[model samples]
Target: MALIAFRRRSPLPPAEAWRRVTDWPRHSAHVPLTRLSTEPPGPTRTGTVVLARTGRGRLGFDDPMEVVRWEPPGPDGTGRCRLVKRGGVVVGWAEIEVRPDGAGSVVSWREEARVRLLPRLFDPPTAWAGRRIFGRVVDTLLAAPPRSAGGPGRPDGPGRGARRRGT
Candidate 1:
């Protein structure tokens, strides 16, 4: 079981941040590779799981996820969100929280995903990419949530991603 955690600071409040996360599918445009399905979904909360695809054609690894748990921070200011795998054995989890610091919010992400027996093929690169991806995600979120639309926002599209080390 490999583990990687990323913590980011957001200019948005806990409530607003929570709203956006729980509403991932609608905001799928902001993420790198994700596809929303037409099937009816459930409310956004602890134990509520949502189904979605990934990569170019996600239909191949058809699996849904369970939200598991959700904790809202107090007025002093700090909230947390946790999620776990649902049906399939390919377990993947992501946790993001916000702590109000002065004016801006401190966002944190902790994720540990397992691809079962396919470890040999998707380990190193996955770890390497996770770190960079998290940073890019943070940068994108810092830019005032594009008001014209509602969804996750990225610095740029696929072709214009942050220049990698060697590139």
Candidate 2:
């Protein structure tokens, strides 16, 4: 199995960081040729299934993952979510954690994956690529937008859309 793990620190608060990291559909925006769908079509919890379909037309594959554990951040508390991949083409598990830092928060991701029919010799490269791709996704998700000149917003800062408009 290919194993990938990494950590990132962000200026956003723990709850905000958890929210950003756990936003399932947003993942499709970051990954190429991928679309996300959740079962039960609402707030996620244990047993929620997140499906990611990738590829073009009939060439696509599904990476269906079921939430095995879910915990949102509490006031001054850490949050954690774990998912188990249950697709014909992919199998493994992933865990995401968000915790309060000095004034912001730190997020960590760890994943183990195995592609059907792939030899174990390629695990190293697969893990490397997974790290690069998922790391970028995490970075993009955690990055905070530039604050407006003097406008007041959340204590952490303005939303990503607002920061983009300022530029």
Candidate 3:
């Protein structure tokens, strides 16, 4: 399996940073030829299955991951989540952690993944690709504006329903 790990710092608060990183669908925006969806279609929690389909029509693979652990940032401003890949073509695990930083936050992503039928000799290139791809995912997520809680048509503007400090 290829081991991938990296960290990024964001000016957003820990909660906001956590929200951005954990929003499953947003991931596909940065990964080429990929689209993400979640099982049960609600707030993410333990057991939520994230399905990522990559490739062009008929020539693709599904990467399904089950959330084994879910802990959103609380008053202390720290959170962690773990997902286990349960796909025929991809297998491994990924973990994400977010913590408070000085007036901001830091998020870390770690994964041990391997494509089915791939040889161990390819681990280096796999790790390199994973790092580059996921690194861009994280950076773009943090840089984007936070999404609105109620979405379009809501009386309030975007992100209005999002939890605020002391709320």
Computed on alpha carbons, the lDDT of every model, listed in order, comes to 0.57, 0.80, 0.83
Model 3: lDDT of residue 161: 22
Per-prediction TM-score, please? 0.71, 0.85, 0.87
| lDDT, residue 29, model 2 | 67
> What lDDT, from 0 to 1, does candidate 2 have?
0.80
Ten-residue region with minimum lDDT total, candidate 2: 158-167
Top lDDT prediction, candidate number:
3
Show the colliding residue pairs in model 3: 148-159
Which window of ten consecutive residues has the lowest lDDT sum in model 1?
158-167
Give candidate 1 misplaced runs (Cα > 4 Å).
36-42, 55-59, 87-89, 149-167
* Better by TM-score, candidate 2 or 1: 2
Q: Flag the better candidate by lDDT, 1 or 2.
A: 2
Model 3, span 1-167: residue lDDT tens: 99999888778899988888888887776789998989989889999999999999999999999999999998899999999999998999999999998999888889999997788999989999998888877777777664658662122212222222210
Please give the range of 10 consecutive residues that has the lowest summed lDDT in model 3. 158-167
